[model samples]
Target: MKILWIDDEIDLLKPFIYLLQQEGYEVETATSGEDGVELARREVFDLIFLDEIMPGVDGLEVLRKIKNENSQQIVVMVTKSEEEDLMKKAYGSWVDDYITKPFSFNQLLSVLNRTLKRRSIISEQMAEEYATQFRTFSEPADYLEWVDYYKSIVSWDLRLLDYGSNDLKVLQKEKKHEANAGFAKYIENNYRDFLNGKGPTLSNNLFAYAVLPVLKEGPVHFVLFDSMRLDQYYKLSNSLREFFEINTEFYYSILPTATPYSRNSLFSGLLPLEILQKFPQYWSFEEKGQNRFEKELFAELLKKHNLRIKYSYYKLSSIQDIERSINSIVNDKADIVITVINFFDLLLHSIPGRGDMKGVLDDERVLLNLLGYWFPLSPIFEIFKRLSKKQRRIILTTDHGFIRVRKPTIIYGGRSISPNLRYKYGPALRVDNKTALLLNNPGDISLPYEDPSVRFAIAKEDYYFIYPTKPTEYEKEFKFTFQHGGISMEEMILPYAIMNPR
Candidate 1:
C-alpha cells in the first residue's frame, strides 16, 4: 500500500514514516498542500495524510481538492490546533481520520494500520462467506427451479460485489458468470418442458396462478412494468412498505421478453400464438413502434372471462402518459388497473444511443444506483400513493428482466430471421444447439409458426444471438449491453407482488 503524507513539517514525521515502512507500507511525503494536491492529481495512492494547517492552500482546501480528484481515496486529517470547530469542519469536509498535534507515533501507526487492516479483514470475510455458500450453491441437485436458483445466486453475488471487496468481488463476479452459463444450459434443457406444462408455471400462466389467487381477497391492480430486473424490484420493494403490505412471488417469463410478446401474453393471460389466433388484428409481430394499443387485449381477456366487474388498462411509456395514469386513479369505479411502465426499457435502449446515458450507466453498479434513484420518484409510485388513499389493491409485476450481455454467439439464418438479440425466429436458423432453447415445433410451446418451415430459437443464458453479417462490428456494439426476451433467470424469473395500502 502507498501513503501520501502532506504536511509543512514533514521532517518531524520521519519516525512515523519509519514505523509505517516497518509495517510494509510505502510512504511518500509532500511538504505543502499545493504539492500534495498536485501529486494526487498525477498519481494514485491508497490513502493520504494531510495536515489541517498549511501555509499555501490550507489542509482543508487540500482535502477538498484530493476528494474532488478521487472521492474513493482514504484521507486522514492531521492538525496542531485542537479547536472543536476545526475538527467539526474537517469532519464536514469528509476526512477519514483525525489526529491531534501531540499524537504519539504509535497512535498514528495504529490509525493507519487499523484503516488498512479493516479493508483487508472485510475482503477475507467476503471471500470466506462466498466460498462457503458457493459449495452449497454449486451442488447439482440443490436447484429444483432454475429461475429461482439462478436469481438467488445472482442476488448473493450482486450483494457481495456491492460490499466493495476488490479481490472477493472479482471472484464472485466470475462465479456469477459461470452460474449464468450453467443456467443457460439448464434453460436449453428445460424451457420447452416448462412451456409445454411438463415443468412449472410460465409467463402465460403467471397471472392465473400467482395473481388470481391473491385477488380472491379484494381488487388487485396487476401492474406489469416492462424491463424491470429482479434487483431493481428488490430495491423498490423496500420503499413500498410505508404505503402497503407487500407479498412477493416469482414466475418465469416466456421467450421473446419484449413488450409485444411477453407483456401482451402477461396481460391477456394467453401465449403469443393464442393471442394471434384469438384476435389476429390485435397482434402485430412485425411492428417495431411502441405497442401502446396492446393494453386493449387485456381488457378483451377480462371480457372473455365474463369477470367484467369494471377494469381499466393504461400503458405509460412517457412522463405525460405517467401523469395521465396517476390522474386516472382518482376514478374509483375500476376494480383493477393494469399499468405497464416502460421507463427502464426506454432507459436501456437510450443508453447506447445517448452518450450521457452511456457514461452514467457504463458500470453495473452505477446502473443499479440509477435505478434506485429513479424508482422512488417514478410516476408508478405517484399513482400508488394516489391509489393508497382508496379502497383497492395493487399487484406489481414485470413481463421480464434484463441481463447485461457479455458473450455473443454467432447465428446464421435466412433473410426472414427476426433480428432480436435474445432470440431469433426463422427457417434454417443455425445456432449452437447447446446454447439455445430450440422449439422445432412452435405449437408444443404455444408459439406462432410463421410458415411450415419456420421455427423459433431463444438464447438460454447470458448468451445473445449475433448474426454472421458484420460479426465483429455487431459484437463490439452489443457486448455488455442489457438485453432480454430469452431464458436466463434474470430475464425469465419475474416479480409478482400483492400489496394493500397500510
Candidate 2:
C-alpha cells in the first residue's frame, strides 16, 4: 500500500515513514499543502495523511481542493488541535479519518489499518479480541457484576458494529441473547429483593442517588430522553462530550419498565404502588396522561426531602416544542430544571411501518444504524449546544429502553388488559411461564393495580405478549417493533450520568 504523508515538518515524520517502509508500504512525503495537493492529483495513493497546519494553504483548503478534484480520495487529517471547531471544519471537508499529533508510529499504523485495511485486518483483530474477552463467560453473580457484564456487552456490540466481521456480528448477537436470558433469570429470582432494598440503585431512588449529590455542588439541568437504550446513549455521548465532561453509570428500572411506572418512580422517589396509594390524584395510566404529573411528583419528591428550592419542568414531544421551550428553560430562575424529551419514544412507536423493522428483528445493528442516521439531524443537537453554554451541571438519563420483539409469546388476557405488547396486567393473566414472569400479586414487585385480582405478566428476553385470539395476524403486525415494560437488559439496565459543562 502507498501512503502520502503531507506535513510542513516532514523531517519529523521520517521515523513513522521508515516504519511504514519497513512494513513493505511505499511512503511519499510533501512539505507543503500545495505540493501535497499536487502530488495527490498526480498519482493515486492508497491513503493520504494531510497535516492540519501548513504555510501557504491550510489543511482545510487543501482538503477541499483535493476532495473537489477527486471526491473519492481517502484523506486522513493529522492535526495537533483538539478544538471542536477545527475538528468540525475537517469533518465538513469530508476527511475520512483523523490522528492527533504527538502520536506514535503504532498509532499511525492503526489509523492506516482502520482506513485502508479495515474490512480485512481490523475485523479479524476485533473478532480475536472479543473471543478472548468472553471465552470463559459465566452468568453474573450479582447486580454489580451484571452491570459490568452488560457494559462490556454494550461496548462489544458497538465495537463489532464498527470493525468486526458479519460472522462476528452474529456471534455477538448470540452472546447478547445468552446474556439476556441469564439477566432475565436473575431478575426473576432477585427482583423482589431489589424492591425491598437489597440491590443496586433502582428507578424509585435513581434521582436521589444520581442527582441530590450533584445538587449540592450546584444547580442541575436534568434531561431525560424517554425510552432510550444504553447503546443509544453511548452514540449520543459523542455529541454530548464536546460540550460537557460526562460521568456515566448504570442503574436498574423497576418492574414493567414503562414510562408510567418507571418514570413516575424516578421523579416521585416512590414505587408504583406507593404512588397510587399516596398520590392517587396525580397518578394515571391512560395513554395521553400517563406521565402528566411528572412535575407534581418531582415536587413531591423535593418536598419529601425537605427542600424548598425553585425548580422548573418542561416536557416536549416535538422539535418545535423543544425549540420554543429552550429559552424559557435556560432563563428560568430555578435551582433545578427538568426537561423530558419524548421524541425518541415517539420514534420507536412510529417505526412499525418502516421497511427496516424486519431487519431490526434479524440484526440489532439495523436499529443502531437508524439511530445513527437520526441523531445527527435531530433537534437535540441544537438543544445540547444551547444548554451547554449556560448550564454548568447536567443530569442525563432515561426512563427505560425498548427491545425489538422477535418472538410473540401467546398470552391470555381480556380486552381490559393494558395493550402494551411487552407486559400485560389484568385479571386472570395466563402466559407461558418460560417466556414471562407471572406475578399473581403485583405488590410483590411494587407494581400498582386497582383491583386485588389484577395480575401482571412481564415478557422476558425478546418475547412480546400476544393475545390468544388472532395470534398469527397480531404476531405479524407487532413482530419486529420495539417494546418495553419487560425483563431484558435493554429495558431494565439503564444509563445514568452527570455532566459538567467544559
Candidate 3:
C-alpha cells in the first residue's frame, strides 16, 4: 500500500516510516501542511496520515482541501492533543479515522490493516465459514426449522453480496432453490391444516395475535409496506436502529401470496373464503381495488375482538402521497394508526427498462442496491424518522414477498383466469403437476370462488405460469421480474417487526 504521512517534525516519524516500509508499504513524508496539500493534489494514495496540530495551515485545513478535491480519499488524522472538540472537528471535516501521538507501532499497523484490508479479510473468512457449513447442510424438517434455515440463507446471501465469490453465490442459489422446493412440499402438506388451526401465526390472525396484545401497551402505529422481502427488511432494519429498538420475528402468509388475498386477510382476520361468506359486500372477484374496503374490514376485525377504539387508516400509493400526508399520519391522535405504503409493490410490478431502472429491475442484487441508495432519501424513511420522535409503538410488516421468476411453465386456462404470472385460477385449469400445485378445488385451500369447479394452479420455485398460446411473448414480458401469489420461501415466510422508540 502507498501511504502519505504529513507531520511538521518529519524527522521524528522516520522510525515509524521505516517500520511501515519494512512491512511492505511505500511511504512518502511531508513536513508542512502546504507541502502535504500539494503532494496530496499531485499523487494518488491508498491512505494519508495527517497531523491534527501544526504551525502553518494546520491538519484540519489540509484535510478539508484534500476532501474537497477527492471526497473518497482515506485520510487518518494523527495528533498529540486529546481534546474532544479537536477530534470532532477533524471527524466533521471527514477524516477516515483518528489516532493520538506516541502510539505504538502495532497500533499504527492495526489501523492500516483495518483501513486497507478489511473487505478482503472479511470475504476470505466468510468464504471459509460457508464452505465449512456446506458440508453439513440438511433439509429443514418443519416450518420452524425452515424459518431458521431460510434466515441463515438470507444472512449469507447479504454478506456474500458484498464479499462473496461467484461460485459461492451460485451454490447459495442452488441451496435456496432446494429449500423452496421443500417449503412448497411442506405447504402442500400442511397449509390446509394451518388454516384449520394447526399452523403458526398467519396473515389472517396476525393482527389479532400480534397487534391486539401490543394495543394494551399504548397507542400503536402499524405500517405495512407491500411486497417487502426478508433481505430488503434486513437493509431497512440497519437504518431504523438509530432511532428505535427493533424486535423482528417471522410469520407465514396465507395461500395465494398476493395483496388481494394476504393483505385483505391481514386486515379482516379471516381467510378469503370466510370473507366471501361473511362479508360479501367487501369481497370481490376483481383484482383491482380489491383492498378498497380495508378500513371497513379493519373495523369489523376490531369489533370481533370486542375492542372499540378510534383508529386512522391511510393508504399511500406514491412518494408524493407520503410527503403530503405524513404530517397528518404522525399528528393523528387515534388509538391506532395504520398506513399501507404501496411503493415496493408498485416497484415490483412496474415495467422494466424505465429511466434509472434501465438495467436494475432484472437483477435482485442490483435492485436491492438501488433500494439501498434510495431508502435514506425516500419519503417512507422520512415517515419512520418522524414517527420515531413521537415515541409511538410501531408494528411493521408486509403483505407478502416476491421472487424473481426464471423458468416458465406452460399451462392451459380460459380467458377468465387471474392475470397473476406466478399463479392462475379459473375453471378447468391444466398445469404440469410436477412444476406446480394443481388444486382441484379452490375452497379446499380456503381460496374464494363462487363455482365449486373452479381450480387454482400455483407455480413452485422460480417458475411463472405462461399460457399455451404465444408462450414466448408471455415469457419475454415476465421473465426475471419479481412476482407473488405463489408458494416459495420468499413468498410465504415474511418479516414482522415491532419498533419502540429508544
TM-score winner: 3
Off by over 4 Å in 3: 1-115, 345-353
Candidate 1 residue-wise lDDT at 405: 83
> Candidate 1, which segments miss by more than 4 Å at Cα?
1-120, 139-144, 289-293, 346-354
Going through the candidates in order, what is the number of backbone clashes in each? Answer: 1, 0, 0
List the pairs of residues colliding in candidate 3. Answer: none
Worst 10 residues of 3 by lDDT: 345-354
Looking at model 2, how many pairs of residues clash?
Answer: 0
Provide TM-scores for the models: 0.73, 0.79, 0.80
Please tell me which model should have the higher TM-score, number 2 or number 3.
Answer: 3
Candidate number with the higher lDDT (2 or 3): 3
Candidate lDDT scores, in order, read 0.74, 0.83, 0.85
> Tens digits of per-residue lDDT for model 1 on 1-502?
8999999999988998998899888999999987887676555577889988889789998887666444446788988887889988988877888778788988888888787776667567767877787767643432245556666665665555334567777776787677777766766667667776776667777767876676666776767777888877766675566578888877777777777778778777888889879987777767574365566776776676677567677666787777765777546466666666786855454344466677555676656555544555566677777777884688888888888887888888899888788888889888887677777787777787768688888886678888888999999999888888787668876777888888
On lDDT, the candidate that comes out on top is 3
Cα lDDT of model 3 overall?
Answer: 0.85
